[model samples]
Target: MKRLVKGFAVSLLGLSMLVGCTTQAPGTGDKAAGDKKEQITVGLAISTQSNPFFVTLKEGAEKAAQENNIKLVTVDAQDDPAKQISGIEDLIQRQVDVILVNPTDSAAVVSAIKSANHANIPVITVDRSAEGGEVVSHVASDNVEGGRMAAKYLLEKIGKQGNIVELEGIPGSSAARERGKGFHEIIDKEKGVKVVAKQPADFDRAKGMSVMENILQGNKDIKAVFAHNDEMALGALKAIQAAGLKDVVVVGFDATDDAVAAVKEGRMSATVAQKPELIGKQAVELAKKVANGEKVEKNVPVELELIKK
Candidate 1:
């Protein structure tokens, strides 16, 4: 009985040694941190899921995360810059390995990006850019080219000669800025095409409707409307119809599913198509590469298309 007790004690000691050699020390940012990692956490920040465009972008990101064996946490900023910054801060505290963000206010997100950098996590911007540094990469469509496409289509449709109004997107948004610049560069050069009214709609459908209604009250001679986004264009369409206006062409950006249907139904003249899904997918892939210490380009440009009936 004494010999058996001694043998059991010796075996127990040996087992303890083996377990200690295999187990990871309890701490943060350790090599074994990934060894026991059952799921990699990724953050997805978008403007709003209410918009069908962002819904598709969310789906693409979720699908990629699923395929790559990662857990995705998504937050909607509701087009509020403050909320966007808070959402990113929450994700960083969660210690997510990577973050994918579609900024509401590009400049506002800059500090959040720096915060993530302090945590040693990688941030990939999608659909929009942030002002300050610490961004690993950015993936988005060429908004300027999209705007140019819209202007080109409108010029062809109206023989490059018409009075038009522009319904701008939310101010301080990179998409709105670039798209507006592109459209102005084209329309400004054309002697016959005149943009008589340009107003900021905050990229809301209702605001777009109200702005269009007000513009119509003063400028009944407007022949065309260019909206920074499809949602605003849809709103403008309602206003134009209510005014009993006809033969007024309306063009929009971001060819969402609803926008495509609108085009087929003759509700909208045309839309500049952007691949939100591709943007989402590319953002995930870039995050993975950055986490793996791989280098990626600062800008990954997605193609744009002009959709017309």
Candidate 2:
């Protein structure tokens, strides 16, 4: 009986040791589970929060991050390239797993990208892509096609023959350049349709108003106006209303909610709706995939729709 009891005690001791090695402590197990959950930090570098398009994009990104269990940090450049570089540097310092950049200047952000690359963080370009780099991916609407769509609508509305003015966006942006190129490519071919005045508004509502006011001084026969973005288009609409111009068709880009309202009200002719939310969602999805060593395409194209009411 004594031997049996001793043997039983030894067996119990061995069993306790095995349990200690195999079982995790309560809090420790919870912590291990939490640690196993995927956690990533994403940096969003955007041009301006002033634009409703960017606002929607930000919202979409935040929602996507939350759904995927990621931490998102957003910084706005406020339309300044230098400020954008500074913002990117700050994001790098934070040691984010990936960066999503909507560059203020395509060329200016190249060095910033190189800096991020040195830190071994993947950079994904959104909206307006950075000029030079092996970025993980770039997601944006087809600006050239949007421009063509707008021009085609305007041409049809004006009976393909009239004087039109163009309020362009920022000088160095790919959005501005492509839109302008596409606009002129179509209108330039129309014999009676003349682009009487063209000026840069820097994609600012107030600046667009000022530029349009100046153009109005010289060109009173303007049959239509095409502003690069909706904000600029809205500004020009204000100017046209103030100038008392009748039947002067106005077209714009980046169909924000306000722009859609404007179209519905018949104050604006049409807008190229570049769905920013979709772009934002795609951008975050691609960033996560790339970070996880999954394959993603270099270029993802977002659709542009011309909304006319």
- Which predicted model would earn the best TM-score? 1
Residue 83 of model 2 has an lDDT of: 94
What does candidate 1's lDDT look like per residue over 1-309, in tens digits?
A: 999999999999999999987776566436554454556788998988877788888898888888888788998999999999899999998999889989898888888889989999888889977778588788999898888888988988899888999999888888899999999888899999899999999777899999999999998887899999998999999999999999889999888888899899998999998988878887887777776668899899998988889
| TM-score on alpha carbons, each prediction | 0.89, 0.88
Tens digit of per-residue lDDT, candidate 2, span 183-235: 88888889989998889998888998988999998878899999999999999
* True-structure lDDT of candidate 2: 0.91
* Candidate 2: segments with Cα more than 4 A from true spot: 1-37
Question: Which one wins on lDDT?
Answer: 2
Which ranges in model 1 have alpha carbons more than 4 Å from their true place? 1-38
